[model samples]
Target: MSLTWRISLKSDEAEGPEDYFSSSLGIIFPDDITNQHGDAEHSLIYTSPHLSKSLLIDLADPVKEDDRKLFSHYLWNASLLLAEFVESDSLGVPLDNPRAAQESLSFDVKGLDTLELGAGTALPSIMGGLLGARRVVVTDYPAEPVLKTLRTNVVRNLQPAISPAGSSTTPADSVLVEGHSWGELEDSFSTTHRHSFDRIIVADCLWMPWQHANLHRSIAFFLREAADARCWVVAGFHTGREKMRSFYDADALREVGLEIEHVWERDCNGVERPWDTEREDDVTERKRWLVVAALKWIQIP
Candidate 1:
């Protein structure tokens, strides 16, 4: 595999876009990597369902996997699937992008409230706003640098879709970025904003099973207690030897007053992924699990 990654990061203290991508944020992929059949690794360009221009995402250096900043750097295969799900489900406006839109769950996204947990790079959350969601609040662990990167992506990808409120630092408009650590449910947001989002997107957040209870509670707390409210959860088993052992903590989710409506194991391509990878024809054996479930409000019986 010649897919070696090189990541160049801009300092969070950078003054402006011009100052941001100076020598400090120069392109990582040199000419050498381009020669390799499978090695274009600095950044990935993905076409959006609505945008005419392709979205460019900076990749994370594999060497810096230990760093927290690397979390929002790389573009995951699961993120692509989630993007496709959005493209398919969203109200289709014909765009010049080569990507074809496929229809998924049929629901009008206009004025819908949405929140995405662990919104690394915020591709899905950005899509929600592009699809006409009234308010799309993308959140990740409370790290200024990470939150800044997510906001950068949201602004970069979605310009015509959302208008930035507050200031360049703290955006609170059609699409807002927030720092939300799972477990501290009530502390993440104000009570006035409780049960605010109608739809929740949880992409690539199940890697840490130990935090399943927290993830579940956060989803329950942020998600509106209504029959129509739903959450789309997707995670890939590409890495982490132990993460693939199980999909999600079903018991913990049920404990938090949520129910799993449907679960599908599919490959990077939308085809069904078998339980046993040995049986599947995919040489990569990489698979993603898509779970569609609604938040069940605890009834006082």
Candidate 2:
């Protein structure tokens, strides 16, 4: 399903052009999964296209008054796209993005330490684990309700092979569910896991302009200081392209010693094209394209 929208920034000026800009961009989270089940607590079983194993992810109610708006409980389309790409890359299955300029895109996390930021349902992280990533750290906002759901998803899908961070018997490939608030530098998660991950996945996290700096900081700080280390980013334009463009064009990522290696536009149908800023912002068409990119740490002299 295409997560498309034309948001009106002003309450009183609803009749005017919907393009008027504002900080509070209306983000629509499309619940594309129809197989969701359970009454009191909802859950969905996801089966990857490339991988044989299936993941059972529990959904937390975000509308509850006291839950602090835990919207990360649901799986977004970008997450699924990223997961599909990674699984294809991991299994050496060639991606069928004919419109892509690079001809071929290479990504595989096998035997590497992987980390996922804003990992709501952790689909990508689960793919990394199943694909033989040396370690997979799944993290999200440090709230208990958010972390609880994240933990449940990770444990239920990857346990026996998964354990908490402090486990003495934790193996090299164990999936660890962690609580991480973006840009919290002095916290335990920051201190213990800095410059650690080889492969970092950031999915559907650039919607909030207010959180871009924090997200960039966390990405730069955690991504390993190596020539091969990369951060894979997948974001949708449901919040509006202008708001999404601000995060990339602000030079904030480059300022932090990270550089965009490559980026492309892939629609929901698995068709890919070169990233074009000059393209028309068709509200209906924009939802079909999800911007996918790879960022690597700048090598110092």
| Stretches of model 2 off by over 4 angstroms after superposition | 1-41, 63-70, 95-104, 159-173
RMSD of each: 8.8, 9.6
* Each model's backbone clash number: 1, 0
Q: How far is candidate 1 from the true structure (C-alpha RMSD, Å)?
A: 8.8
The lDDT values for all models are 0.56, 0.69
How would you encode candidate 1's per-residue C-alpha lDDT over 1-301 as one tens digit per residue? Answer: 1111221223335456654444332164222222111111344455442454566554323333343533555555556556656654564432222222223344345568888888777877766666567787888877666677777778776655332231111124667788888868666373556788788888777667667777777888878878778777766664443653343445666677776665556543344533342233232344333322333445411
TM-score per candidate, in order?
Answer: 0.69, 0.78
Error of 1 at 158 (Å): 1.8
> How well does candidate 1 match the true structure in TM-score terms?
0.69
> Model 2 TM-score?
0.78
